[model samples]
Target: MESRRRTFLRIATLELCERFGFYGLQSVSVLYFVRTMGLSEQGAIMLWGAFSALMFGVPVLGGWLGDRMLGARRTVAVALALLATGYTGLASGMGGAAGVSLVLAVLVCGGGIFKPNITSLLRHAFSDGDDRLDIVFTIYYMSINVGATIAALAIPFLAVHIGWQASFGVSAAVLWIGFAVSLTLPATAPPPAGGGDRRLWLLLGAGIGVAFTLLHYPALAKICIWIAAAAIVLIWIVLYRRAAPIWRAGLKLSFALQAEAILFFLFNQQIATSLTGFARDHLAGTIRLAGVDWAVQPGQFQSLNNLWIVIFAPCLAALYYHAERKGRPISVPIRFLFGFVLLTASFVLWRAAALAGAAGPISPWWMVAGYALFSLGELLIAALGLAVIARYAPPDGVGRLMGCFSVFGGLASYLGSLVATYGMAGSGTASTAGYTHLFGNLAALSAIVALASALFIPFARKMDAHWRHAIPRPSSTDKTPTEILP
Candidate 1:
């Protein structure tokens, strides 16, 4: 148990460094596209959306590589190298627009390979049905936010004071540092039984082909994303059919929860696009705290999401831990409903702020308050998303299912970006009305999701019971399963 705990910590450290680089780049990416790349605001938003979509969308292939060809550790090592290379390319600024696009292509490929496998590697340290999985994953989630919060605060500052290229260079440096740290960690999973080298070469070839396609064919890339999404669905159907009868209920529930998670990601996308735009166009640059006014960069507002997550994640994790100790732990489905409720309130709060500040800039406090709710909702839904897969997904194919989760999220992210684009007012136009309408629409959607979650509770509980009974207890010493509500 102590060794497993140590393994989790080391893996979490790797996650922290990876997120530091990833979110650092994301913090300044849109503005970099607008200010440095000479793209229009809308174009920048769409480009960011596309980049996000691909970052998530490619994980299906990555998960397959980890599950079937390369082991989790090897896959992650390769991904870290690719990510560092991509960030270095961005820092170099070699080819202008084309150069940046090519670098983005590298990032998408690297990110796709990195995201799912790392999480799978972390989960590999624990046995199936370990009661501590929820708390462990929640803490793991917080590690990600910890990295994001620091990067969010620091990278934007660097972008503003130094140069954009310099900020990206920092991201590259962080990843290389992570790669160095990774060497000391023991392998948590073994390589495949055979053909690992042959398959590694094949995946490398395929990755290069993918990068070339993304660099040269923008429209084709979009089409490929949709095609990949369709393939993911088809694969899910196949997996469901092939799963043992006892495992089918859990897999179905996992799929349902992941689908619902898509809505949360839609709202999540606003932090990068519309919300950042709002901060730049409407809010004051400096926020007043206790006694002093502190200046803030618009990009730094993105940090609020991570900051709030860092503040609240441990609290929620403790609550879950205590509840489980009493054998009345809060279920993931109930948490999902609560998440949507908070998300609804967040959008409503933002809408009220937009309306109240009709005459002039609003208080940055409003952004702070809105993000508090938004981040809590994120903790409930997004943070526990992997927990859902971990608890319910078949042990044999959990890695692939994790990738499917990313695919659903990527699709939602792209759709959310489209939604944000509609709320974007033209360069010289008043944005208040548009933002108000957008927030109002989001609030309504969130309410509808909340209601659906409530309706689905009974079904989810039934599925939970089915899964609990179907799987044998791992050992005599394993803790009893928490009681599910009738």
Candidate 2:
């Protein structure tokens, strides 16, 4: 157990570094689009959304490669290297909009590959149905927030003081360090004993080729996303059909939770895109603390959610631990409902801030409060989301299912981006009325979902109880399963 903990720490540390690099670039990316590239608020938000979609969308392919060909550790290492290269290009600043787009596209692919495989590796390191997984993932997510907070605080300051290019350069350097660390980590999962068939390789190659081509054409890319998404749903349906009766109920619940997750991210994703626009247009230029004037940029405020996470994660984890020890543990559906309620509150707070700003540029404190709710929601939902995936996925399909889990984020990003684009369409600037209406609508949607999830909690609990009874518990001496991906 000590050895496992140490190995997990090593993997989590590397993940922290990778996230530092990823968020460093992401924190300031929308600002780059708006200020450096001279794009409209709508254009920047849409582009950010598209970039986010690709980041989440490519994971299924990455998971397939990791499980079938490269192995998890190998896949992660390759992705880190690619991310380094992409950040380096962004830092060089030689690229116009087109060049930046191409660089970001490469990053999207690398990020997609990196994200799921890391989660898969962590799951692989532990035994199936391990009780410690929840704590492990919570700690893991805390590391992510730690890295993200630092990036969010630093990148915007660097971009504003030095330049956007310099900020990106810092990210590139961090990613390279993570890549170096990755090279030394022990392999968690081995590839199949025999090499996969030639046809599988051909299919992967063809898929990559298609993705590359469509990236240049946004319309085609969106179409491809829908088509691929449909295919994924079909695959899920087939899996459900093939599952035995006991497994079928579990699978159904998994799909239900996943569908709910999409809704969660739909509202949660605004922090990267529309939220930035709101902060930029509405918040005061500076925050006065202890009679000291600190200028606040929209990019810098992106850290608020991470900051909140860092502050609250340990507390929340301890709360969960205490609850379970008391024999009154919180169930998944209850947690899901908590997350939705907090998320809904976040939008409501934002709506109130927008209304308040009609009189003057609102205080950044409003955004801070909103992000506090958002952060808690993220902890309840996204962190637990990983455990849910590991719990429900077949040992053989962990990587693939984790990849599919990322699809929820991808779909949310695409929908959020489209909504942000159309919602603020023809509104040249971020007007008070526009923000009020936007946030009002979002709040209402979140409220609806929260109530629905609450209503379904009883059903979910019943399903989960049956599912738990159906699975065989592992003994200490049992060998952990090695998934062989076809």
Candidate 3:
């Protein structure tokens, strides 16, 4: 078990590194489109929405392949290959929108295969009923934020310094690195309960990784992510969960989980949506420290959010870990409350920035303040929820459930874009009024989120209890086929 833990850490390092590489490429995509692609601010929001949705939406398909067809190992490698191709096309500027759209679509789908599979692989490292879950999830959360931190710093600088296409090239490079790592991994990675080791296949996979990195064919990449994704889908069919009498409780959890996930997803898109715009438009001239440069771009402020995550994820993880140990306060519902509260505060920062913009450049600290608050909110609900979700859902269908988790975020992003479009479209040019309408609407949404959450507390507080009652507890007379006790 200790050896497996060590190996899991190694894999986590590589996986997080991959995440950093990918998000670094993604974080500044909106800025690239707005400044480079000549998209309207709102149009950029829409693009962001589409991008986010596709990135998330593809996971259902990806998981299908990972579980049913290709398995995690092949699915991840092939997805990486496709990702590399998409970036190659993006960097070389080899095609028109149609071509690029196809490339983007393929890349998005590839993400579906890659993202969830990678996450699922990490999660599976902790077995059913493992007591170390909270700690393990915290460690996993750190990697997520660490990747985000890198993305926040790297992508914006790359985009600002080079062309958008070149910025995209970096994404390809990251995925290639991930592919290199993936190939070397022992097939026992999601470790077979009982199995044999095959080093030759690992080396062969490495060669393929090198070859594709050398190749700049988006077409090939798309084909690869697609095939890998397709393979996983077929595999999923093979592993599809069978119905059982106890599944009713699990199904109820799934429905609530879907709703819960969507709300958090909406919460996350703020980074790409209003948050980015707020930083860029309002903070270029403010936020100076004696030794630090305030000349940093708006997008750069996002780095602070990820940085705080590094500081906070482990702390929050520890808090919950201890709470669980003592049988005291920690649980999903309470954590979710914090999420709503923090998100509300994030909007307050946006509101403050809007109010202050009339004076001069809104203080960059305001941006940091908002992001920090938002990140805090996310940690409580958005971040920890991923771990909780795996816990609450049926183990047999975990990937598909996670896929829904990813989709919830996409749906929220899509809604945000739609809201932003309609919220801003009817107004005049991007003036104070335009900003007002946008910020004002976001504020309202944030408030509603808070209120909705507060209302849910009474119901959610009873969830674990309700769930316990809803299912049978193990005892002498009631020996179940599986162990699913709290």
Candidate 4:
């Protein structure tokens, strides 16, 4: 138990630093494109969508490399190095818009490589049946938010005061710090078992080439995304058909949960795009809290999402742990249903605020309130997403499945960006009415998803039961697996 705890902390710390750098970049990315690069709001959003899609879409390859080639630890090391390099390039402001886009491609490649493998390593550190997995992942989720919250708050402030270059440089420095921390990971953590240095070099070269090509030809993003989406579906079908009968139920459950996750991410993507824009244009810049009026930048408002997560993650973790200890743990399906409901309420709240502020800027408090609910919803869904794969995916294929999960999320992100484009103000000045319409449509969509989730509860419960029953249990006399390393 002590060893597992240590492993968890090390991995979580690494993730925290990576997230700090990544979210810092995200906090200012769209704004940089619009303000620094002189792109229109719509163009910035579209480019962001393309970047996000590729960022997540590449994880499928990363997962394969981690699982079948370079190993998770080595892949992560390479990814961190790539990320640092890309951020440094951005900080230098070398080639203008084209240069930034090229560096973004590098960042996308780095993110794709890092995202899946680190979580897979954590999942491998524990026994599959351990009830603590949910609690562990929930805390892991909080670690990510901790980094994100700080970056979201600080990076944008730096961008406003110092310069965009300085803020990006900070991100580069943070990633280098993460790389240093990665070296301290315990030897017990998974090590490279397959593929040689040759394979690693080849993959790195191929990834960069593909990322650069996709970025240069933005139109290819939509086509590639659709093709990737179809490919994932086909792969899932093949996996389902080939899986053992006992594994089929779990796969079905995983597929359903993953589909739900895709929908949730569509809403999640708005945080750095539409929500940030809304905050910048129509929302009050100052928020009152406990008799203090605090000024916040539009980008800084993105921190509210992570801030709420930091405050509530521990509470949710405790609730989950206690419930499991009491042998009355909340079911995933129920959690997902509640998540969608909260998401619906969040959009509704935002919609109301947009309408109320049609004449002028609304109180930032509306954002705070909406983000609280939205963050909780994210905790229940996005945070647990990996837990679902860990709990339900076939052990041998968890890495690949994790990658597939990210692919779904990437597709959803692109779709969400498209959705946000509709809300973009055609002129220089953004109107509250555009946001009002967007939020209203989002509210309707979330409500429909919530209803669908509620309706699927019974079926999902049956799937859960079959999966639990199908799992093999060790006898009381048998020792726990030592693969996790003590």
**What clash count goes with each model?**
0, 0, 14, 0
lDDT assessment of candidate 3: 0.62
Give lDDT per model, in order.
0.81, 0.77, 0.62, 0.82
* Residues forming the 10-long window of minimal summed lDDT in candidate 2: 477-486
Residue lDDT tens for model 2, 39-136? 77667766766677777777767877788787889888888887898889888884566666767777877787888789888888886777888788
Extract clashing residue pairs from model 2. Answer: none
TM-score of each model, in listed order: 0.87, 0.86, 0.78, 0.88
TM-score of 4: 0.88
Error of 2 at 6 (Å): 7.3
Residue 471, model 1: lDDT of 79
Choose 1 or 3, whichever is better by lDDT: 1
Which tens-of-lDDT digit does each residue in 40-147 have in candidate 3? 666666666666666766667666667655667767777777677777777777553344455665566566678767866666566575787766776776777777
**Cα RMSD to the true fold for all candidates:** 3.5, 4.9, 7.4, 4.3
lDDT of 1 by residue, 359-384 (tens): 89888999999999998998888746
Which is the better candidate, 1 or 4, if ranked by TM-score? 4
Q: What TM-score does model 3 achieve against the real structure?
A: 0.78
lDDT at 87, model 2: 88
